[model samples]
Target: ALDQEKKQIEKEMESLNLAKFERLILEKQFRVLSYLIEDKKEKVNIVSCDELNNLLEVLEQKKQRRQDIKSHLDSLNKELACSNFDFEKAMLYRDLIDSEKKRLETVNLSIQQLEEKLAEFERN
Candidate 1:
């Protein structure tokens, strides 16, 4: 019957659409992963759920590192504030604080970029 044929065609079209959508998601994941792994030389063919989980883990580690650097910087600031004498020690603390600040900035930028990429991937 024509009705049966039409129904079969519709089911095939639905299946094809689902497959296309899944492929699109995988492609997006691959692109995001590639961007995140810019420094690595390994070639990535397909992105999997495990890769996304790894990305989340990396993001969390970066956040923890940022917090650690912030706390260390605070301690250095307190030390610098309390030390009225020993100019060399104060200068050393200042240098350490400066380096920590720079590191924090780098981590913050990295986190921002990752979040933006994840958001974009979700949106698409």
Candidate 2:
């Protein structure tokens, strides 16, 4: 009976140890994954779902900015064609148009960069 009791206890301890070792392994995997995430930045493959989501969010913001610029351009174009167009306002809008065009370029560049990053991530 005593021998039987010891064997049962030994079995329980082995099970506990196995559980503890598995927990440690999971912890290590999490730490390593975090490190890889930090190292990858916007480069490629190593990006996790969270980072990809963040990139998607940023892309949405850029797209919104592009839309805003386009709408403003349309408004300005209409104003320019109006018979009572104010020269001062036209000058201001022209300047704004130039800036908006530059902003559009930057937004496009950012989109291109993100697309490239996604492609690289996929290829990996």
Tens digit of per-residue lDDT, candidate 1, span 31-101? 33433453131122113342555556667766876787688678768867876837765665676677678
Top-TM-score candidate index: 1
lDDT of 2 at 118: 60
Residue-wise C-alpha lDDT for candidate 2, range 1-124, written one tens digit per residue: 6446646755665566465335434433443443344334433422455366666665665576568667756765675576364776567557655655776686678778877876766677
Clashing pairs in 2: none
Itemize residue pairs with steric clashes in candidate 1. Answer: none
Q: On a 0 to 1 TM-score scale, where does candidate 2 land against the true structure?
A: 0.53
By lDDT, the best candidate is 1
Candidate 1 Cα outliers beyond 4 Å, as residue runs: 1-50
- Clash counts per candidate, in order, are 0, 0
In candidate 2 the C-alpha lDDT for residue 87 amounts to: 79
| lDDT of candidates 1 onward, in order | 0.60, 0.57
